[model samples]
Target: MRQSQNGGKRVLIVGGAGYLGSILSRKLLSNGFKVKVLDVLMYGREPIEEMLAHDAFELVEGDMRNISTLVKAIERVDQVVNLAAIVGDPACTLKPADTIETNFLANRALAEACKYNQINRFVYASTCSVYGMMEGDEKLTEESSLNPVSLYARSKVQAEEGILSLEDENFSPTILRMSTLYGYSPRMRFDLVVNTMTKNAVIDKKIFVHGGGKQWRPLLNVEDAAEAYMRVLQEPLKNVKGQTFNVGSEEQNYQILDIAKAVKESVPNAKLIVEGEEKDLRNYFVSFSKIEKTLEFKAVKQLKDSIFRIKKAIEDNRFSNINDPKYYNVEIG
Candidate 1:
């Protein structure tokens, strides 16, 4: 294969058939990196079905928690990106044991395996929800104290700590505390705030705003999130190694009510409703300066753009059934 910007480096993405992983794997392969995906295919193979034919793409169907499977997958791979997890608040709550085992324990095991295999460069996918909630208008940074409110966030926090603890001179690990993601993916997710709102506006013709719609959330497109991973992997190790960066644009932060309004604006016939005064405890925005300055990474997709894109995809019948169990993590996971 002709060389691309990534210099044909082989990188293994654990759980690479999930929503974010599927997108990231495609991005890596398109940019000249040989991509090896290790996934149990919990959501099924359709997300990666088209890519199976790509010369640079290789799929290893196995569980990341199995030591033997992980060890074999890491062979001949230069770096590893861990994106394997139960992945959302409700989903994690439903399967607490699996969440802990996959998100936290499996992550630690993955780190140990990478270290043992001498794969020094590792990028771990973490979530900005680790901040939980912040007082006033404060925008939480990587240095801010964590107050994870959900089992999902807590598991990710524990995994981040566990992986970072394994960092040494020979093992370079970088943690990316990503903002809540939206936009369309092969493995679409309607569980997220933005996507849920957009789906509601498109299907139900109404968007519900709970907790007085005052909670703050930072949103990033699935594509932008994938780009951030590519940037980190392509950059010099000294710049990203042993570092934690929140991945999102400063301009993408929006109040819950405002997100509903944006979706309504995209689908003009949709009505917006406010339900209950009880706020969502997991309310926080994040700072992306660390990544912007260090890796020169900035999310290019706007919230309105994603809303419109999703709306168009829905209108185009890209998904025969928008209510599929596979589109929702809580439903299928």
Candidate 2:
């Protein structure tokens, strides 16, 4: 594996209309990469439509399941970032079959296409939810055993394994296990915990805490998550290729109550409500040491800053129709 000369490389970003994909596409374009975004655009392309005007940007409206579309999208691309997926636990639960097909099987198809086309780098967006539950004080690393709890996590694990298996002398596959992403996006989602809490606080002056809000988890700002990908794209291939790196910071780990406090700190008028006897079984704190040591990467955004941004966005009506089903992970239609 050889280091890629960052500038002038062509990148194909699958699911470019989605949250992380849209941000990553913009970051790559700003860094001078020729960008082609392949998305089904299920929600809309408004997030990236502006980039289409750029000479370096191209859009392919298609599905990953379609091999013909994947082939065409992969053409003349130096690297591929697979971000196309059903996304989130609720979303995957609502569309279990589609989740399996898109998150797992489609990835298999993408791997085959990349291998056949001899693509330079393949970066897969996986999640830390693969570490479902932790025993004692153990902090999970890339080497930690996976105990995936949801269909979404399971599918990501499958995709990660399959993509790595396809890696050889010609193909370099990098898996990024990202922490729970928050913060504003061009395609903003109120479905995420922080955003949802902040929205409820701003509109109704109350935020609900489910199951006493005790479970622990790591969080990362969307911009920081996108930055991790850029680092992989710019770094030496031998350092990142065929390796799985956890992308996040230990400083962001917090209990559910801690997040609620953070939201209240941003919105002092907000009240707290505890409801439901059911606890979300997924709980774990992850270590980001591997990526930090290897890539010299560290998350720059803090939780307070994310809280402030979401609060301001909500207060200023930046996210109008926050109740829209399209912005939520649950499929209303």
Worst 10 residues of 2 by lDDT: 324-333
Across 205-253, the per-residue lDDT of candidate 2 in tens digits comes to 9999998888888999999999989889888888887899998999998
Candidate 2 accuracy as TM-score: 0.96
Question: How do all models score by TM-score?
Answer: 0.96, 0.96
Off by over 4 Å in 2: 1-5
Against the true structure, whose lDDT is highest? Answer: 1
Pairs that clash in candidate 1: none
Residue 107 displacement in candidate 1 (angstroms): 0.5
lDDT of 1: 0.89
Model 1: residues with Cα > 4 Å off, grouped in runs: 1-4
